[model samples]
Target: MTDKTKPEVEPYDGGEPTELVTIDIEEGTGEAATAGATVDVHYLGVDFESGEEFDSSWSRGQSVNFPLKQLIAGWQEGIPGMKVGGRRQLIVPPALAYGPAGSGHRLSGRTLIFVIDLMGVS
Candidate 1:
């Protein structure tokens, strides 16, 4: 894969997403991801309500590798069918993200936006 710069996540203003929303920004010709596969990716995340950045693999100067099944529900559902080298955006509601208002996770009850670059799938 070619070296890619960090992506910026645009604020979502179309109201809170009730479900997982996936938008492909750049398409890829490599293998597509599956729910059960492990993936290597670079991503940036921001709060939908505040447009504040929450996390970024690019800031750490490394891509992350993890099993899809272990990720948040939105990712499990959204990342599948996305090809390696592709860049995609996901708008995830609280339910599919960190859970409801009292779920204890810092991002609970918050809608989130993520720009993910698929680097590898295996």
Candidate 2:
């Protein structure tokens, strides 16, 4: 995907999700991602409750490369099966995100929404 525009993540008003939710905005025909793959993606993250942006790779003018295994549970579960060039949204509950309250991470205890554009998988 060559588009550099950052995706807008709307606040979720449907209440906190009890499990990881994955929604594909655009489908891709490239190689599919797997649980053990390393992926390159551009993404935006927002607090589900506050509707405030917490992070964005678009802001940095670069995509990020990450090992799926090192990411949060939500991403590990949500990203697999997605193909390169796809744009997807993931709604992550605290347990699958930073974990429950007092997990030491600032986003702990809170649900998060993320818009991810898959660039490549290897």
Candidate 3:
């Protein structure tokens, strides 16, 4: 018999059905981050489970400015404390990600990997 626990390739869920794996940040946003707070950043969203890319700003060479708190729970918890011009990666679990049903545009039940670039905060 073969050992199924040896680990094998499976469909990527974007961390949608798994536990969150948090990466330590040299700096992170404080708990004071509020909604509508403006920030500049570039990010990439990938499916950690399936090893597929979902989104990325590096390819576009653009950083975006938006409220960190206004983003999803995972993003809210992922971003912050990153100094301007800093970059970081976040592994979001499914619970903290899109949830069970997933979302539109090929984002369903997937764990998300984000490489975020901090540009400015406003």
Candidate 4:
């Protein structure tokens, strides 16, 4: 959310990311993923463009797994196609993150950034 007059950054300001700048994933596209879809991802989430680091699985030395529908819109759309042991990134936009509601906390109304690594897909 910059002045709009400034160059279009990935995440933008007000969207003050930790790193402060910019930055997707694999396989199944349209269809929904199943519960057994055992997904292994190393992610780095932030406010976008600012390339900050709100969350990173790698930093914690781990990955996450869950049903497709349970994830965010961006994740539901982004975390597909990844075969078991595959890895990728997810450059999520604001609309896809918290939508209009926003997270209310530190998330507020900011665009989110995520580096999703598709480690494994069941």
Candidate 5:
């Protein structure tokens, strides 16, 4: 398994993100993602303020798979509104992310931003 922080981000030097934000970069024509659905996605994670890339599925050469219900709170909330083939940018607040405790050294007390491409759902 990959390290949790590998796909999240390094702890922000700044304070937490003030709110949750989602931007649809591309709208898809396929099924709308729903909770509990197994989804495949390609994502790039970065620091919202700095635009410093933290991780990318493209760099890894493969998409990742998981159930929407099992993802981080921000993803669980943001992704449900997306459809297969859609791409979205998510700006996650700390309360909806790793929170004050954080995920590990990289994501300690950090908010996060993710650009995700929905590939499939089952």
Candidate 6:
């Protein structure tokens, strides 16, 4: 695996809930990702407000595989159209993320920011 540098992302300030936002840092080559495609990505996940990193595949030195449909609404919606080798920053509203129910202790009722590297698709 090739070592990828971590991409920078803007943190979400405290605010009203809104839509998912995606910023393309690097445009990738080949077909755009779509629903039902399995994607392999390296991602750094951070708290939207605090900018504290909570998870990262890049830190792990490997990518993770996931079926698009099974991911969170934010990922399911934002990850599509990203080509292989692309880099994107996603600001996910709480509604599109863990939602009201929230996830684990750290992410309860919190919005999320992710810098994602699209490594492969199948």
Model 5 segments beyond 4 Å from truth? 1-17, 101-105
List model 3 lDDT by residue over 27-111, tens digit each.
Answer: 4433323345677766667777667776665566566677776676777766655565445667776667777553662565666
lDDT of 4 by residue, 2-120 (tens): 11121122433353332212222233233333444656555667655455567766667666766677777767766654444333455555566665544565665566766655554
* Local lDDT at 57 for model 5: 86
Ranking by lDDT: 2, 1, 6, 5, 3, 4
Runs in model 2 with CA error above 4 Å? none
| Global fold similarity of model 5 (TM-score) | 0.79
Candidate 5 C-alpha RMSD relative to the actual structure: 6.5
Superior candidate under TM-score, 2 versus 3: 2
Model 1: CA > 4 A from native: none
Runs of candidate 6 with Cα error greater than 4 angstroms are: 11-17, 101-105
lDDT of 1 by residue, 84-104 (tens): 989999999999999999999
Write the number of the candidate with greater TM-score, choosing between 5 and 6: 6
Instruction: Report the lDDT tens digits of candidate 2 across residue range 18-109.
Output: 89989998997899999999999999999998889999999999999999999999999999999998999999999999989998999999
lDDT of 5 by residue, 22-115 (tens): 7787788789888788889889888666668877987898889998888788999899869887878788976777766545646656667998
Q: Which ten residues in a row have the lowest lDDT in candidate 3?
A: 1-10
Q: Which stretches of candidate 4 lie over 4 Å from their true place?
A: 1-36, 101-105
TM-score of each: 0.96, 0.95, 0.67, 0.61, 0.79, 0.87
Q: With candidate 5 superimposed using the best TM-score fit, by how many Å does residue 22's alpha carbon deviate from the native?
A: 0.9
**Which is superior by TM-score, 1 or 4?**
1
> Which wins on lDDT, candidate 2 or candidate 4?
2
RMSD to the hidden true structure, all candidates: 1.1, 1.1, 10.3, 10.2, 6.5, 2.3
The residue-level lDDT of candidate 3 at 30 comes to 36
Worst 10 residues of 2 by lDDT: 4-13
